[model samples]
Target: MGRLCKLHIQNDFKEFYTPQVTEGGVVCITRCDARHKTPLRCVYGSCSMTRAGPECECSDRAAFWYQDQVCRSRISKVGVAVGVPVAILVLVTIVFAIVLLRSQRQKEEYRNNLRSRSELYDSDDGNWDAPQGFAVGNPAATWEDMETPSTSYINLERVDTSRNIHIRRPTVVR
Candidate 1:
């Protein structure tokens, strides 16, 4: 059972990922293949060395800056930086759409109610007329009795107030 639990044919390095056993657990990691070692150098971690080096000594637990075959780190900072704003924008758009849809629905309902009431009122007289008291200063006049008024008006208001004032000649009283 112990021999079956030991991994000996893997290419990548893993830290503290072995299965528990009755006897003990192995902490030292060994590479079965030599193709995982790369010439890349980490730029943001504690050490500048590559995760998989010439020797089998990488623990595979450091926060490497880049993703390689041996060491792939999490990108939580970048994910949160972009994901939070995108989530907020999506939520705001959804809320705005819902508000606009509700307002349009309310307006449609109001128009429908007005139309139904107008139909019921116009049922008696087949001729559709304006609502009661809608016409100002023409309560008794029907639509045919109203006439187009003439546009003859006088513009007598003084509009040139900014011009120079005329000086009155002094009387020859001297």
Candidate 2:
């Protein structure tokens, strides 16, 4: 009995012998070897302890514990290890989606701008439907006339009392 008492005191002095009542409960801790198939039997009152179990599991053991099933330190560590990376990946995916959406919107805006500019360049007369180099009205003006580049004139001036407002007149000289 002296040996058992000495062993228990040596193993659980800090948790059981200590007078600081951390939590009210009978906490059992044991170090049982699976190969030996040793049963954990506390001859004295319970206290917190660490040890190997009947299975391949080794962790802190408790009995009549008020809290939920004690998740071992290793399990909590593994959870943290996996959870952090998964959260980061989710955040990255969200950011990538936002960037992709923004780029698509910018591309659509650019396409619309190009379409508006093309419409502006389209001639209002029936000649717009005619093929390139087709002379209208005057047959004397041949393809050579169409090839000639023309100067463009633009007039810009403030239209409103506010500096924000302006008017522009664009004339294509061809």
Candidate 3:
């Protein structure tokens, strides 16, 4: 069998490709009857010099760069004047997505911290108090673990009987 990559041409495997360079808008073709084993010197419609025998040296102008067969190169929406801004916009969107992903990671970390704290409280002993730190007030004072009465739930009847009602609204100080 022939090599897996080698082609078995039925009719010379003739294919056509546009030449690279041209005067203005001319379409060029290589010689159809080139006898060279290498297709390198087989540019179409080239008016320049020919290579020696077995060299098959085609012109560089009609290579990949000039394969469109036109003097001017091809330009798409990506390279067009209006396309630059669109590319910049897409890049900005990607940056925003990255930033948002980073923020979500931070949020996930905070959520994990909260979950751990809750777990600590739900343990067997059931006492997971907040640690001592520089909170909003009284940073230097220590906490007293002595049992205290429910001062926050004072009886309203006792206060009503003990105190007199004030008639006027409190005055604001500037």
C-alpha RMSD for every candidate? 18.4, 15.4, 18.2
Instruction: List, residue by residue over 89-125, the lDDT tens digit for candidate 2.
Output: 9999999999999999999999999998776445432
Model 2 steric clash pairs: 27-47
lDDT of each: 0.46, 0.44, 0.43
Q: Clash number for every model?
A: 0, 1, 9
Best-to-worst TM-score order: 2, 1, 3
Q: Global CA lDDT of candidate 2, please?
A: 0.44
Using all chains and alpha carbons, the TM-scores for the candidates as numbered come to 0.33, 0.35, 0.29
Write the candidate numbers in order of decreasing lDDT: 1, 2, 3
- Per-residue alpha-carbon lDDT of candidate 3 for residues 1-174, written as tens digits (9 for 90 to 100): 122112322222223322323466433233433422334343433332233222223244323333343223434433455678888999999999999999999999999999986764542322223332111222232246534332223333334454565799899999
lDDT of 1 by residue, 1-174 (tens): 334335652434343123333345443322332222333333333322234532322333432233443333544556677889999999999999999999999999999999988774552323333433221232332356455323322223523446676899988976
Output the worst ten-in-a-row residue range by lDDT, candidate 2: 64-73
Q: What is the lDDT of residue 115 in candidate 1?
A: 96
Q: Report the lDDT of model 1 for residue 110.
A: 100
Stretches of candidate 3 above 4 Å error? 1-70, 74-79, 121-174
- Compare candidates 2 and 3 on TM-score and give the better one: 2
lDDT of 3 at 23: 64
Better of 1 and 2 by TM-score: 2
